[model samples]
Target: MKSTWIALLEAKYKNLKAPNYSFVLDEIGKNPYAKVVEDIRRGFSINEDTDENTDISFGYVLFLAPGRDFLLRISMIAPYAFLAKIKERGSTSQPIVRENTQDAMELDVLKILESHGISMFDEKSLKIGVPDSGKDSKSLYQWMFVDEEIPPWS
Candidate 1:
């Protein structure tokens, strides 16, 4: 699992190409997906929920890269103690805008994630409240990172 996570990030850094990109990883309790939904509804407050209340707690890591014309989003979730997610966006308005390829770049990034042994899920599992598919549904990358063991570097 550690190697897979590491490989995913290394691939993103090497295989992906974008001018505006960001990678983020964090440790979260189970139900992160649900928490995100709650945040969207409750003005995005972190103090409202208890860590112990986390049912499917885990860690998540993400990578986001944006270009002048497109955007990319990638993420990994683990039941252990790590988390990461990535997001990217592109502009389709005009050719004169700088850093406007976020959408295109996002697609490219997603492809990379898929090639790196990442998995995308159609719906949330019975144990976790994550949606199977929809607006906030888990992507293939998120599915790829279902394990929870942290790497040695961490």
Candidate 2:
């Protein structure tokens, strides 16, 4: 299954000529295949035009393993910028709602970008914060959003 998905992504990358792209893969709370799971998730991001001479686009893919086959979801985030925010809403409790804000930080994101030879200035470039749920183990899903300000020129 992982091979099929990787092949599909490679095919898409070859067929689509987008200036930017990103991918994310989730693999938490699932049994290990061969070795211990070093990372719970992975992701990638790409930006070709630094001068704004071309359309800015981005893509992301995620995988979730729920005791069976892994679940994968790929998304293309267009109109890319330097900073972005992702929010996760908590369920209703005690007449209060919890809102968590963050940016994309799946490790695979950087790997994918590097695979395409895309350069990033610093590791701090991607800023994402996951809320600390009451439970010891909690899965937090993030809704990605672009920042209002222009990305800093590097």
Candidate 3:
């Protein structure tokens, strides 16, 4: 029964957040793909919440490079989808100087979604979202990624 775009992409993958990979691992510090990465995760092929009332949505940011199976998905003009539609019609009309309101995707208004036949973004079935502890993902990536809508990344 879980199909309103997989419950809105598992409610944005349980609001996933585990970002700071030390500035892209210090710019892949020595760039041998950081000596065969064994970890780094956040992947969801496509999430096109294409405006019923315009809250803004688009996709492509999968960087699940575990062990160099690599997935440097890109296509950004995002600045957080118009500040996540101004934090859903009301929140940050004032306080934000780009430390990260989660949408440095600027304002593409939800393009590049390539229309429902979908394309690319299967860097070999990547799925990594964790937080049911480690202090509930330390603030807001309260994870569970869909275990029969599991909210647990089953």
Candidate 4:
């Protein structure tokens, strides 16, 4: 069966026109885990605007682990715009401020998910980290949100 989340996301992207951009929805057989991966690779150009290259991708993994534990993992290629904005404030090494910013983003993502009928068993900030991207040692942020219990599917 298709997941409601995947269906919703697919619907959102149904009208996209970017070439080589697609969404991959997968589930672990007999396991309470599912993932939605989006890969976008395209170029943009306008009659009066500068051409631009786009290669952004991201994914969300929803896992219902043993003991009814629920977790959501998000990984993305940090956009240069976002990195620039953060750098304008201060070094990313500032734990407190960086954490707050990450928490805010996480909340926004969660709110969107929740609005679509997903639920959270607890209120807590997402755990975030900036790790080597493994491509060219670039850094990418990973966000992890945890819930004690999974809510009813909507």
Provide the overall lDDT of each model, using Cα atoms, as 2-decimal numbers.
0.29, 0.24, 0.23, 0.24
TM-score list, all predictions: 0.21, 0.21, 0.20, 0.20
Candidate 1's error at 91, in angstroms? 22
* lDDT by residue for model 1 (47-106), tens: 222222222222222223222222111132332222122223321221111133345433
RMSD of each: 17.0, 18.2, 17.2, 17.8
C-alpha lDDT (0 to 100) for residue 120 of candidate 4: 34
Q: Which of the two candidates, 1 or 3, achieves a greater lDDT against the reference?
A: 1
Q: Rate residue 44 of model 4 by lDDT.
A: 12
Each prediction's number of clashing residue pairs: 51, 10, 13, 0
Residue lDDT tens for model 2, 18-51: 3122232111112111121123232222222221
lDDT of 3 by residue, 29-57 (tens): 33322111112111222222222121112
Q: TM-score of model 1 relative to the true fold? A: 0.21
Give me the runs in candidate 4 sitting further than 4 Å from their true place: 1-103, 123-154
List, residue by residue over 19-132, the lDDT tens digit for candidate 4: 122322211122122211111011111011111122222222222222221223321111111111112222222222233445454444344444444333222211211222
What is the Cα-based TM-score of model 3? 0.20
